[model samples]
Structures are given as C-alpha cells and as structure tokens.
Target: MGTATPHGARAHARAQHGTRTPTMPVVPATDWPAPPAGAGPLVWAETVAGGGYAHKVLARGTELRLTDLHGDACAHLVLLAAGRPWERFNAADTVKVQWNAYLRAGHLLLSAQGRVLATLVADTTDGRHDTLCGTSTLVLNTERYGDGATHCATPAGRELLTLAALKNGLDTRDLPPSVSFFQGVHVDANDGTLHFTGSAGPGGSVTLRAEQDLVVLLANVPHPLDPRPSYTSTALEVLAWRAEPTRPGDPLWDATPEGRRAFLNTAELLTCRGQS
Candidate 1:
C-alpha cells in the first residue's frame, strides 16, 4: 500500500474540505490512569545516538512516553489515524483544541477529525516545544558522507516515509509533507517551502496520550540548518515505553477534582522511599 507524501496528503485533505481550516474544540486535560505494565508490544526498535534505525507502530488508547535517559536529546515524531489514512495530523487543530500554541504537560494530541487522539498528561518542560515539524527518513548514498560508502543506505528523510508506508500496508511512492523537530520554517520568494534549520537537541522528549488506535512513526535526521544532501542518519538509541492502563480506582485514574488531589497525594506517598 503506497501512500502520498505529507505535502500531497495535506493537499488532498484541503481539497476535501474546500480549503477551509478544520474545526477543533478545546478540552481540558484531566488526569487519567496509566496503562498496565507491558501492555504494548515493541513493533520496531532503535537506539539514540548510535544512529541505527527508526521506530514505527500503530497504537490504540496507549500512553507513549519518550524519556531522555540522557538530557539534550531530540526525537522526531509523526502521527496518523489508524482508521483514516487520508485524514492525517493537523497541528492547527491540536493547538486550537488545547487552546494553546505550545504543547506541554496537560495537553492533548488532537486529530484532523477534531478528536482527542492523545493527551499530554505530564511533561518536564511545561510543553514549550515545537510542533510545526515532523519526522522523515534518511538515505546514506545522497548525503555528504560521499557516494559508494561501505553501507548501501544511510539515514535520510524519504526512507522514514517508505518504512511507515510499508508498516501500514501502504506503498512509499506518495510521501506526505512532514514537519521536522526543532526545524525552522520560512517562505522564499512567495513560494511556501518549509526548510529545516537545525537539530532539536538533547533531553527533549514528547509523550502522547492516545485517544484511539493510531500509528506513529519517528526518526532523527539533519535539520534545516544542516542543509547538506539527505542521508540515512541513525539515532544513538531509541526507547519505547507504554504507560499501561491502571487498575480500576487506581490513583492515576482520578479525573475529578477531588480524585485528582487524592491521586497526587497517593503518588507523592509512593515516591517517598519508606512508604508502605
């Protein structure tokens, strides 16, 4: 199953909506129970810094937490609805739904259909990160490392798209117009061409609270700042952790005001070294 590029996909979506901006509703971020231990299966694996491969998967009602085991690390992320392939991610909708431009702790990941796909339950940075950019693949041959290298393919932007398409039973021919992490965007000569600026460096982790079944793909490539030929650059390491759904009446399940307070108290106690 080959899919269209992000740019093409967006264009198609626009055509369907008559170029009108999609509507999204703001929702409060309420505390929800975490997932049980080991509920999510590891679909793909990669490490940060070592620069090997990227990770991709389709998750439903899952809580994905990308921890910067080491600070100053940046992970590129892309999300799409499992049910609707053509209806992809809309950053504007997400911002509108959250009632804020920046996503941080206590925000939700909104889908193009005006649904809450995930929630930002907790974040260290208070959600002051970039959402305009997405992730992509890398090819080694076309990079600055020189042609005819030891390996056939290195990391590049387009490869990630191909991998995602393959995993989703789609072909890689029609890649989507993807945003980059920590990449800068600007217009040139009245022509809209989003460019990458630089790396979305260390300790920068983003977590999404899955509202429904969704497929997410991630990669690490050069930023707009690099401006060199594309290549298949791998990550040093990549780790995927799912916060399994907690048991009924679990502290994390508290959604009401009173429940939230109680949950926080319980969480604090659990964090204490000598709590029973």
Candidate 2:
C-alpha cells in the first residue's frame, strides 16, 4: 500500500499557511475632448425653493452650462474622481492649483491627486465664486417652519459625498469632507459657518469645459422667492465637433461667436414660450 500521508500533519500545515492572491484590477483613466465653444442648448429646469435639490453625473469631456434664468440663483457644486472614492475634490488643492481664492473661467479644477478633472472655461463675473457655502439637508425638527410633526427639506453637503461613494462602488460611510458653492462665509466665535446667499443677476450664466469625463450634480433650494417661476428653462442642446480644438486662452472666453448665438436663440425661445 502507498505510504499514508499523516492527515493530522497535513491539516495542521494547511491551517498554518495561506496562498498568495492576485492584486485588484487597475482601472485606467478615460480620455475625452473638451466642450466646444458652441456645444448645445438648455437641458431642463425645475422650480425650487431657496433650498431645493439637483444632481448629475458628467461623463468625460461633457460641457455643463448653468444659466441664472432669473437673478440671485445660488448653485452648490462638487467634484470627484471617476472611480476612486478617496480621490475627490479638495478646496485647498483647487485654490492652490488656480493660485486664487475664487474660481472663474480659465481655471483648472484639481483633484486631490493633482489630476485635472474639469476646467473653468467661462463665467459672467470675475473668478470669485464662494467655496465655503456648504450643502443643504433635510431637517427633522424646526421651530421656524412649524411643529415637530412637520418636516422641512434643504440642501446639504452630504449629498455630494453620497453620490461620490455611490459612483465609486464605495459606501456612503466613506464620504470625505466636502466644499460648498453659491454661499457666503461667516465666522461666529472663530468657528466658520456658511450662510445662504442670493442668485446671480437674471440672464447671468457660467459654463465649464470638461478635461475628462466628469459626473456633476446640481439642485435648487427654497429661498426668498415665489414658489412659482422658481426655476424656468429656455432651451438645452449639445453641439459636438469632429476634432479636438485648441483651448481658447483667456479674453473673449464667453463662448465662441457661434455659441453666443445658440444661447441667444434659446433665450428668445424661452421668452416666446413665456409669452404664450
């Protein structure tokens, strides 16, 4: 008979040692062209209170144009890496990359790893948007609104964190600290707090050119405005070019002549609709 292996010895050895495993698959970054000067028209609009909600995932190289159909609209924006949860937008990093306090056209939105996620191609105002406003959230109890039974809704910074995690296959538990937009900063006893601000002037707008595929989210919360006409849209369109073009440098950055025309046409359409 063949020599019988010592079963107890083999079992003990197996328990004492483990086999090596292969590493996880590495995902490569996606390459995409930037948004052209004249890309498209309005997508959609929803009327929201001072504190409402909006969110979207922008693929690599997709341009997002935000228009303040009416004046004093506040938009809170956040950025994240396509697949890495830990690699998200850091305000400190963005500020250092741009070498300025506020973000404006021609600025690059840098990720924690120093990667270019999006580029600020155009803006109606000087590059001075507030980054410390924070997000809105749902409130369980509030004396100003009503009794404990009544619930109030508001935007919150946590929403962006949740979306970042969801996209990266990570749980919301791992969301990092986030920044805010369209808000003002206040200091009380040296502790910083974000206060609600008004919207930009009517017809004011800003547009971002994506360097790579990006996911974006936006929202509108209830503020001091009539619930009706809180949000309205003129038009939304997408224009694609056959080839990638050079970045348009600074000055005259508002959309190429063609883009301006498309925007104006959309605005007129909206005006006509309102009249009807």
Candidate 3:
C-alpha cells in the first residue's frame, strides 16, 4: 500500500516536481568573506531583495555591513537603542555634531541624547552617503509606481520600515527618519539646492560598529530622488559579525573632540545600565 501524503504536501511535491528553478533556502552561508582581525564569528547574514525590509537587534560590539550588490540598491536604515527604545537616531545631531554633512569611515552616528549609536568603521562608497534626504514614502512611491503598498511588488521604504518596526514589538509611532547608503545627495553650496547623485557603483559597501545595543531597521528600495523614471532597485547584501566596540584609546574614538564626547556619553549610559 502507498503511504498517504497530506493534501498540502502533495500539492507542494507536485509544484516542486514541475518547477524548473527553485528559490534559495533561508539558511546561513557557509562561505562568507573573512571578518576583521579579532572579530568573532558571523552572527547574521542575509540578502535583502529590492523593495524589501530587514531588521535585527545587534549587540554593542557587533558590526553590520551593507553592500550594494548591483549598484542600484539604496540601503535605507533607522536605528533605535535596544535598551531604551525612545533614544533613537538623530540625523541632525549626526551631521551637526560631526560638523560634516557627508559620512565616511571614522564618523559616528549619534542619537538625540548626544550618545553614539554606531560608528562608521569602514566605507568604500567614497563618502557618497546621504544625510539630507530620507527614504521614499507610500504616497510619493504610489505616484511613481502603480502601487506602493506593503503587499505589492514595489513597496515604499516607509511601508517596509513600518513592517520591520511592528515585527520588533514596536509600532508605527516608533518610526523615525532614516539615512540612505550607496546612493547620495549633493547640496549646492551656492543656492542650497539638493541634487541626487545616484548610486556609487556596484560592490560598494559600508560597515558600522554598534556603540550600543541597537535595533536596526533596513529597507532596500529605490531612492526617492533617483532620476530613473522606473521603480527599480537591485539586491542588497547584509552581513553582520562580532567585533570589538570602540574604546577610549581607539583612533575613531579620538578622531574629533565632538565624537569623543559622544562616545563618552554612550559609554557612561551603558556602564550605568550595566550593559558594558
């Protein structure tokens, strides 16, 4: 007698048999590139499809890397303090405190409380990340594309992030302004006009080390200002591994007095909370 197969299982078996190509399984890659010296084993690794969302809670000493696989993905990110959800990323502080509008290696991402959230430890995108412009919204994306809802093929960045927030036990109210990597914006110094510079080319990557425990939300979508008429974006590679957090004597910690103060603030909070 033949063994009985459940209805769902029988359907799945038939579909698999008829399929020419199968999607990759969601499993950790056994062969990722080496991490920095003294770094721990990889903790997270995944590929985010275009117009997709991803979120993760990283420890204080971990490093997260985002790569533009095909030179068209805009990795929009929003960071919140894992221990204290109210303390989220402050873009104004990140730029004003550093006295620089552009982000690069050694730059610190600051929070509203004047504490450091993450540090830009490595960047290959030539400091072409945007600090002025945020992610795309459902309304704008809907106007550009036929549909911008989360259930559609071309979900807006805001909608994707909203989903990420909800998955992490938060709500829409927790959403904050985000920063975009790989694609950049240029401000006309003469007239204060913002210009979209497009992508930084393929294989560009940026790595950020967590200064505090963080809940990071990422959306890989087309930049709102992208000149391309169509809603198109390529795949994005997300990799994270354990790494040593910045210390007082680290070059990045002392890169600038303002940055140093921010790191000190972060350390004090972590130490007081016994998270250090």
Candidate 4:
C-alpha cells in the first residue's frame, strides 16, 4: 500500500492504477493545507438548503452526518484526500470492493489507490444509494424541465460542484465524481436495462466516518434519476462531530482487513509529507 503526498507532494499511485492526474495535484491553492493549519482544532458543521453546494476539509476520525430535511431530497457527494486531491473516491472500486452495488452501512468508500476515504457507518434510507444515475447538468435540466426552468431554477449539480470546488482551493477540474445518496436504481436483468425509481421515504439520512482527512464537495441538486413533474429541489443538512478514535480492533478495520492496510498507508503518508 502507498500513502498520499501532502500539501505540495507528488502523486504516487495514479500510474499503476487509473487515479486522478491533476494540474495542481501536489498543492491546490486552498485555504486548508495538509499538515493542517494548526490554527484551529477540528470541530465544525453547517446546514445547506436544496440546490446548494458545500465544501470542507474534514479531519480524520470525524463523522459527517447528512440529513435529508425533506422526504424527496438527494445529496450528491464528491470526496478526495486532503493531502493528495488526485487520490479521490473511486465509485467503481467501491462497488466492486464491497461486492455490492447498493451502498449501505458497512460499505467503505474506496479511493482509486484502494485506500479508504470514508466509511458508511449508518444510513436511514430505503437502500437506494445510486452510482449509475449520475448528476444533473444545466442543459439536461433545461431539456427535462423546459426553457422557463433554466432561467427560474438554481444551477444544476455540475455547476454546484464546480462552485464548491473553487471555494475549497480547487478548480472545476478538481471536482471528483459524485455519489447520489437517497436515490435508487435497478436493472431489469431480463432486458439488461436499468431504471431509476424510489426514494428513502421522508427524513432519510446517512452517516459517513472519515478514515482520511478529506476534501468533501457536496451538491443538493436533484438526482439524474429524479423525474418529478417538474424541477424540484430538497433541503439537506450536514453535521460534523468527533468520531471515536479508530484502533486495530475497530469493526470497520476488522471487517475488511484490507481497509486497515489502506488506513495505515494514509496515516503514514500524512505523517511524512504533512511535516515537510
């Protein structure tokens, strides 16, 4: 296993694996730099409405709680290691690593380098975590909702991601692929076709435990699978609190022995490059 380079360090895993190759991979011009600011201790949170964007550098051992204030809400998430933005969440790897397509409790969000970014510790959904539906774009939103919608409604998911990334010392190009929570998708095995349907009922929520210090970008725009009568957005809230320190016997570590190796790699990487 290999760790990430911090603040302004070289990426070491993308070539062997198809991880990100960024223009500013070593150091993004963001407010928070890897060795950590050391100015403030890690304790913070915020609530964002639907059609909103949020970005934060979440510390390791912290838990991020996302709540769907409304029943029909969707939250798209993009995650990257704080030290190495290039090492981002690999959805394909995650689906395959866990041997399950539907993201639920106990599923670990894997990075392209096979390291853990975050772990799904708890969820309040109807088991509809989706990766296939993708995100909504301005053009597509207009096409689906009509010309009036383009002008009246807030920006779609892509724009929201871009804006959030920029605020966090990243460009639109730095935005990682996203996972749409509270959205569901199923494939018609017989026909080999896929269909998007279902929701987590009302007040659905998910809790993620950060295994690595991370740059998290979130958008509360509608999911691509969403086909409501017209354009509708839902409000979502984000809460970050202290997470119990992870030890060798931690369930997530014990469940997936590989996860332990990944976390060690991240810890070592941060320790080394973060000090430089």
Q: How many backbone clashes does candidate 2 have?
A: 44
lDDT of 1 by residue, 1-276 (tens): 123688877776666652322111111112112322553543323344422224455355456656443433344555665646654556776666455555556555555555444556656543435565544333333445443222234444456555656767765543444534333344343775554434344455555555445666554444424455554333433333444423237443454343344334433433472422
Best candidate according to TM-score: 3
Rank candidates by lDDT, best first. Answer: 3, 4, 1, 2
lDDT of 4 by residue, 9-52 (tens): 33444444533322112222222123222223335445566677
Q: Rate the local accuracy (lDDT) of all candidates.
A: 0.46, 0.44, 0.86, 0.71
Candidate 4 CA-lDDT value: 0.71
189-269 in candidate 2: lDDT tens per residue?
A: 465443433434465556665544445544333231213332222211112222221133434223344333323442343
Locate the minimum summed-lDDT window of 10 residues in model 3: 18-27
What TM-score would candidate 1 get against the native? 0.52
RMSD of candidate 2 to the truth, in angstroms, is: 17.9
Q: Which stretches of candidate 4 lie over 4 Å from their true place?
A: 1-42, 147-152, 257-261, 267-276
In order of appearance, the predictions have TM-scores of: 0.52, 0.53, 0.90, 0.77
Clash number for each model:
71, 44, 0, 0
lDDT of 3 by residue, 1-276 (tens): 122658767777676663332122134433454544565677777778888888899998989989898899899999999957899988899999999989989998888999999999999999878987889988988898878999798899999999999999988888878989999999999999999988879999999999889999999999989988888898888888877899978999888899989988988898999877
Q: What are the C-alpha RMSDs, in order, of all predicted structures?
A: 16.7, 17.9, 3.6, 13.7
